[model samples]
Target: MLNYLGDKKDERMKMRNRYRKSTALRCDAGSRCLISVVIGSLMGCILLLNLYSAIRPADEIGQHIHLRTSHHLHFPELEEVEEENIQIPPPRKRSPRATKRRPKKTTTLIDEFLDEDSQIRHKFFPDQKTSIDPMITGNDSMFYYPGRVWLDTEGNPIQAHGGGVLFDERSETYYWYGEYKDGPTYHAHKKGAARVDIIGVGCYSSKDLWTWKNEGIVLTAEETDETHDLHKSNVLERPKVIYNSRTRKYVMWMHIDDVNYTKASVGVAISDYPTGPFDYLYSKRPHGCDSRDMTIFKDDDGTAYLIYSSEDNSELHVGSLSEDYLDVTNVARRILIGQHREAPALFKHQGTYYMVTSGCTGWAPNEALTHAAESIMGPWETMGNPCMGGNKMFRLATFFSQSTFVLPVPSYPNLFIFMADRWNPADLRDSRYLWLPLMVGGLVDEPLDYNFGFPLWSRVSIYWHRKWRLPQGWNSLK
Candidate 1:
């Protein structure tokens, strides 16, 4: 009876050992299964992320496409616009000399600025009253007195007219460059339009967007040399700059033509420095085609492209610049053909390309059109004028100005500074700069083929304000 009891006990112990081994194996299998599932999930998520980035448009297009310039600009790229940085200074105190004497009948500054015959005309022009004094404190502190003669740090009127701004990141400063129209303005031919002798490109730098220091004429026209491409009598308007990382040089492109604008070609210039005496290389009909009213855009990935109104102002051509950022590559595509558009200011929001253009009218305000494209090349869709808030006349007239440039305020989303020129054809020197608030919002007024039934982009509206500054926080981020 004792032996039989002992055998039964041994059998029970073996059974218990077997059960323990089985439980341990099961736990190991479960852990392996869980690890496999976790790894698979992680890999799947990474794949989806890559695919999403590939499809996202905004990821591809950067802040407003950067215009051409001659500097290693390292300004941080902005994705949205905020209110402008406008700090109004305190009122000015009368100088002791002026306080000691009876104030000559206080003619209003605006009246004196507008009156061509006023004795203070010189004050508003080349004289001291309206002269842009960088050293002046008080009301003039960091104020852009529009229509007032803006003097450089050298106390000379900055010659950058119809110009564009290039934010240089490397130096943490902004460079203002444009046509230096210093020469006298006159009619080119018996029936030709009024024009000034080409004076090349003017460069100015500003830390605070208001106070500008002149860098001098970076590209000066050939004064007495008629054979030169930049001959003083020739046409050189709307000079734009871009940096070419490949070539390691600043490339400039401008609208080069004769007195009658018969030489319908784009001129190219190069400089090693931002403030430069650029070397005029040559002019060309880009892609073996006529180009006018042209501008260049540099992408975030270092790829640059050019857009020009071509085929007798009936269409536009867009082509990518070579890797070196100088000449146009063989790749060329025609967009907005037969659209009869000019004065294009292109910007990109959320990977979508947006452009503002005016009709082919000469020196007269006409209806403006805003266009968009998924790609920079072809099939651009027209989405009517983006002008809003103003009366019908203001919307149709682009606030009585022509599109020059759309400056983006860093801190504001969908808000931009619409810069235009209210050209005084009778007196070009008296031309006024019209800057309005441009906001992109609401369903587009028109339908697009790509958008199916609903509009793909928000409507673009330029609000007309008699006097306005960028909304609060526009430049606060900077």
Candidate 2:
């Protein structure tokens, strides 16, 4: 009887341990759900608060706050007569040769953006007077003029085009690293498309996220070495950096190919500093699969992963990096197979992974799709275009741009910064950057692969704005 009792007690102990483990997992799941709710709620509150403030009467807000009285105004009071508001310049007439070739349709934001002579071009690429000058104050503070030539602290247009942002905790500064294309844009071969001499990766540093300081070329292209992968005649685009703690190195992975883009491999570089004269290690097809338009993501736990469009841009492959982040581990899984997607930018929120990708259109705007997965791997769901607002044309054109990065705002949970490249095939170097507010909330409009009838994640939306700024005090919160 004692032996039988002991056996029963052992069984009970095992059951208790199992029960405890199950409870812990349940609690974790519950915490994740709570986090999602809290994030969604906070975003909703911010949106409502902003809307209220926008609609609230200016007098009402003034009534609540105390104002200092002075006989001689220290700051100039509103001038009674603002001579008739500055008149908008008239639109320029299109060349007869151009009009004769093709009739102009109703002008679009894209048309204005593309037309070098459009009256609205000034609005998109503002004059030096309105550039992101560090000396500028008021409404211009922390404002990003997407597509406009952004100048560094030295009063020169920043060269980091097609870039990515990396926030370095070690330096407490955000580094914007990208291609420094300062060469003439021209076609390579007789039939080849527009190309430019590989200029190298540029780096810029910023504390307030507005005024940037040029850090010079971190990785310069080989000029004389024709066999070199980074030879100036070759192609290099979309350079992204992520710090690896285990290796204690800043690693950069970029698209490296020839003039015709036949060498479809990712080139890896390593540097001890963020401003890198990175040592070019090697280039290879990740998992022996062709990679193009890729980005690396570092998880919260210090595990860096690579996501690249592979199989001739038919699908995307994702895999965790080796502990050192130098090589892709043997284990890799193909996600979004046969999807024909490229220009991938990924972000995670509320324990759910989201990716924004553009269709494989060469240098033209196309509809963007947002994909979601419970895990970062298989069984992804394709929701419709995430763009909202603006006229139908703007939404369809993705605000006239292509996906490059989805930057999470530290202060606002659901709010994210959507960065895209507005390529000008005519002048590759003249391509512009598009940064807009992206929010992940509201009901998922479509079905998931496995969750047939259930809505598993919130709908991702990138709102189009002629001009917009982050919510006030957002930086302070961060």
Worst 10 residues of 1 by lDDT: 64-73
Overlapping backbone residue pairs in candidate 2 total 0
lDDT (10s digit) by residue, model 2, range 1-478: 2222245457546544643523232346658888778869997997787588559998764443212111111111111111111134554588999989988666556665566676655554555565566656686667766666667888877776667899888888889888887778888778887788998999999876668899999999998999999999898988999998777899998988888877889999999999887999999987777788899888878878888888789878888888888888866666665579998898988777899999997776778999987777645678879987655656777767899888877666777889888776666666667787787765556665433243546778786665566665666226
Whole-model lDDT, candidate 2? Answer: 0.75
Candidate 2: segments with Cα more than 4 A from true spot: 1-130, 449-451, 475-478
* Alpha-carbon TM-score of each model against the true structure: 0.69, 0.75
- In model 1, what lDDT does residue 171 have? 70
The backbone clash count of each candidate, in order, is 22, 0
Scored by lDDT, model 1 comes in at 0.68
Question: Model 1: per-residue lDDT, tens digit, 303-391?
Answer: 88888888788878788988876688877766665579988888776567789999987766778999988788756888888776445
